[model samples]
Target: MMERVHVLVVAAGRGSRAGEGLPKQYRVLAGRPVLARTLEAFVDRDDVAGVATVIHADDRALYDGAAAGLAGRDRLAAPVTGGATRQDSVRAGLDALAARGAEPDDIVLIHDGARPFAMAELVARAIAAAARFGAAVPGCAVFDTVKAVDASGRITGTPDRSGLRAVQTPQSFRFGLIREAHGRAVAEGRHDLTDDAAVAEFAGHAVTVFEGDPANTKITTSSDLQAAELRLQTALLDVRTGQGFDVHSFVEGDHVWLGGVKIPHTRKLSGHSDADVVLHALTDALLATIGDGDIGSHFPPSDMQWKGASSDRFLRHAVERVRARGGVIANINATIVCEAPRIGPHREAMQKRIAEIAGIGPDRVGITAGTSERMGFTGREEGIVAWGLATVRLPVTAD
Candidate 1:
């Protein structure tokens, strides 16, 4: 069996350098907390078996609110309280994992919770390198001339730029090796080490260097946070809109399901699924925006397994497809066209349900209703129809 890969996110810093008030890790970046994005980088992957976050004892409420909407938050171990220093924080995380039954041979990646842009490819490289060598860290070659300056503000020496590489986490190691190294440091009272790789090196472990992405920059100041926001906007340059329309004939039933809500009605919509016209239209709209065909192409009526299935499943699938393509649902506007069933009472419920399924805030979803002026099928009170418009933001290359 392959050894499990665990991640320890160190976020216990005071972050005084970033700014006043909230800590940098809890700061909003590209619509979410930096720590939440960093956690997603590890927890979203199948190769990672578990995740542990080390947090400041005073920031429990902040961490909880920031990480409330994370997709796989249940996979995270109960957060442990960090210590006075970065090294101490890492040791606390390691100890937490050990208490939770992490094996000695399991791979541990110690990451900075402030760096939210660590890509999956970079993580894979670190894992591969750590498996080959007992310890490894991600590094990028220096492109600018480097100078070592003294406290007097004079250049002490100009180092060879070609030989220097700027390193970034997550620093990977065998669990036993890093734990022992940290223990040794504690015993010897060596608490000044900056990174985990340095601690491993101090313990006489040969640390290998792997390729690191320049985009995986750490947020240390207000300017760094602004730059990260700008970078995210630049990457998500491709925005597209898609419209979907779905109709279902009325059948004999006391209640109708619409947008995952059950409403008392004289007749219900009929279809292979739960016949939620609102959700069906929203699902197709999301899929169309991502160029992933329509809802029928994914959950065809010909498939018996989907018979009487809740339409929320279809909507959830469409949302996941958008995420897989590095896209986000910027806004969702759905309208229900019906004559008999009044939708005003259930509009808020519908919006909340759609927002939950799409992994976005309820404010981003809009729900409205209309009548067909007593002309067509909906006007004749024989069926209901729904139309949805979806705006999606995707990475430019994803187009």
Candidate 2:
């Protein structure tokens, strides 16, 4: 049987260089958190037995928010609090694994939480190299010219690029061996070592190298984050737009629900559900973008289970369906045609409610309200009508 490998992700750094907002690991890449994507890369692998993360003492809330939906996964361990340095943070992660009964000779791969693009093939290579050589790191061939400069800013020497390599993580090692190397380094006051390989060499252990992918770039600056965003957009090249429209007649009530928000009105819309025309139309539009069945097909009006249900549930279900197909909702726009309630006063509230339900920003959800100039049922104040448009991005897959 193949041995299961443990993964340790270090995310304790403040990321001061990445800018002034949240830490780089907690920053949004595309739509999801960077650390969330990194954790997904390891959690989705069957070969990974467990995953642990080291975080700053004050980042528990941030980590929890980043890992919100993944908290239930059995293989994800509770985060460990890290110390001042990167080496200290790595040791904290390793010890957390040990406390959970990791064996002495088991393989452990330490990775950076900011590097979200490390693929499965690279991880497989790291695992094989660690099993064979006991200590291994993934390294890419240096493609640019190498220059050694002095502190005085004078040109020193140009080295051969052919022999140089740019090392990246998932730096793999035997669990017990790396732990002992770290302990020895601490005991001898060797706190200046930068990486785990240096600690291994200090303990007289030979480390080998495996092929690394250039796409496994770490996000350290604003430019890197922008590049990652472009890469994600390019990967999801299949863009689709879908439209939906729904109308509901007026009923005797003091309030009406639109776009998951309740507004004071002379009468409520009449339908099988809460009669939220905006949510129903938006849900249908989102489903259409993913080629899923319409809202009526998923939640039939004839079904007693959907009677008087909140329309937000329908929209949330459509969002889940889009995600299941590996699709991202680029934006949603809706126009409500009603003369009675006056939609301008509640436009921002409607947009925020829909954004919350769809897991997107309010800026991505647009809501506009206008009347039919006394021509249609909406202008006659008899009912409400909504037209919805959804733009989605999906990966191009084999048919």
Q: Give the TM-score of candidate 1.
A: 0.78
**Residue pairs in collision within model 2:** none
What is the C-alpha lDDT profile of model 2 across 183-283, one tens digit per residue? 89989998888889888999899988789999999999978898999999998889999998999999899999998889998888899999999999999
TM per candidate comes to 0.78, 0.72
Clashing pairs in 1: none
**TM-score of candidate 2 relative to the true fold:** 0.72
Q: Write the per-residue lDDT of candidate 1 for residues 1-399, one digit (tens) a residue.
A: 676899999999989999897899988766557887788788778888888999999999777755654555557777889999999999999999999998899899999999998998999998888788989999999999988999998999999988899999999999999999999998998999999998998888899888999989999999999999898888888999999999999999999998889999988889999999999999999999978999999999999999999998888788778767777667899898889789999989887777667666677889989898998888899999999999988888721
Model 1 segments more than 4 A misplaced? 1-3, 11-17, 20-40, 43-46, 51-89, 143-163, 184-193, 201-204, 248-275, 301-311, 339-353, 373-384, 397-399
Off by over 4 Å in 2: 69-74, 242-288, 292-326, 332-390, 397-399
On TM-score, the candidate that comes out on top is 1
